[model samples]
Target: MARRAIDEGYKVRCLVRSSKKAAFLKEWGAELVPGNLRYPDTLAEALVGVTQVIDASTSRPTDSLSIKQVDWDGKVALIQAAKAAGVERFIFFSILDADKYPEVPLMEIKRCTELFLAESGLNYTILRLAGFMQGLIGQYGIPILESQPVWVTGNSSPIAYMDTQDIAKFAIRALSVPETQNQTFPVVGTRAWSAEEIINLCERLSGKDARVTRMPITLLRAVRGLMRFFQWGWNVADRLAFTEVLASGKELNASMDEVYTIFGLDPQQTTTLESYLQEYFSRIMKKLKELDYQKNKNKNKKEKPKKTPFKQSSKANSQ
Candidate 1:
């Protein structure tokens, strides 16, 4: 989103906890504003002359008081600051069903912030986004049993997945269009998917078998199992931590037909499941191929062991 805004020739000022980490954005000619949500003055200072605000901040797991700091108190501070500075429209990036998904502690913060925006009288346009496919790319660090499996709790709900790029495009549109004023857009793609279905698709694409183990929430003990959190790649904490909200219980099958009607262009691109897997998990496949080849080389060496010198000599003499 920062890249898109900067590309659109807007004098984009990005607020990051550390300006040093924003080298990529700065390279794209965006002005970096060093600020932390925990500090109201710093947040207020960052929005002094800013016209629009797009919040993509994450609450660190170690911050026990982050709910009050960033999600609730920090957002309130930003809203108040934006209003005081006479900012035009507050473009908030929020999560879907943030209020409902309290099991994930972070979303609860988003819920409170959403309420604060609506009541802030700042002509806020909140974009509640679904999960991002990009999160699965990095060292997934999944359990390496005989079959790599992701642990899931409860029903394999049909979750609506949206590309981060698409969401950014919508966000850029919101920046220029006046019709988007004071509207809350629940943004999603054309299709919905379940965890098991996604796994199946990946396995099929890779021509390999993937095992999925479904565990009920009741089975997880906070003290024993969840505390150490050995597995995070596809664990509950991982899903909750990476996602802005969970689409697990709800069948999020509704298309952004409404958004298309309003925007006049179908935001939905023709990215198939195959394309998604290739784009996201290509590295995994490459690594697996390397491992397989190495294993084959070792097996061949073992199967054709070096001929015993004495035994071969005796056999040749006998012959």
Candidate 2:
């Protein structure tokens, strides 16, 4: 987020839950303000004298409340507070299909937030981001199979994926000036791919055997349930679900023609799926090498058990 704002040439201020965690960002030139999204009063101090407010904190796996709490209630309070602070423009991160999939928690919450913003009468721009490309990195934890038959509910959606780096670059463009006011963009990549095609791409990039398999719609909930039993990464299935959306052969982006024209920003040039997956797999290999080395070292350093003075077997050995 700071990367995007800073690239916009905005003197960035970040409201963080912890100052220490933000140290790297502070060192990178972000001004740190302490606040929580849940508390609007705390935001007032940080937002004072600021002309624009961006609500960027969205969700994490550890969150106990639904996205509605984070995206609506928390966001609404902050919006109300920012308005009272006399702020003018509001920028928001949103999702594609927010109107279509109001059933999905993320989409449902984003719609609510959008409604609030519309009602708040604040000039705003909403970037309904393409499914974040960075999410692919998290899905790496999904168990790899030989000829890996990845299951999906829908395998025909034409996914328009976007790199976060590109999203950040574009966001910076929007923020550097005031071109994106009162506009909502459902942003995505220039191209779309099916889930099967995406899986094949990953296989080629990783040099791993895998295939995309379509799971019957009736079994999706059960599969999600079964996967939940194992302790694993939170984003694994979410990434797959997103991929499945595109694999269903449905196009996710509706505004690509005007995305650039509306924002008056050039389309971003950055890593593509091949480059992103290549680098991702390379990083995984590096981490696996480190783990293997550590495992070997521990295996070689087996310590002898300490002899107990009270144990008869140890006493006999000593004698």
Best by lDDT: 2
lDDT of 2 by residue, 98-161 (tens): 7776435566677888878878888888888767677755443243423445655554665677
Residue 51 of model 1 has an lDDT of 79
Q: For all the candidates, what are their Cα RMSDs to the real structure?
A: 6.0, 8.3
Give lDDT for model 1: 0.69
Q: Report the Cα lDDT for residue 233, model 1.
A: 21
What is the lDDT of every predicted structure here? 0.69, 0.69
Poorest stretch of ten by lDDT in candidate 2: 233-242
For model 2, the superposed segments whose C-alpha errors exceed 4 Å read 140-151, 211-215, 221-249, 268-270, 282-319
TM-score of 2: 0.75
The per-residue C-alpha lDDT of model 1 at residue 220 equals 44
Model 2: per-residue Cα lDDT at residue 301: 86
Please, what are the lDDT tens digits per residue for candidate 1 over residues 269-297? Answer: 63544576676557766887899999999
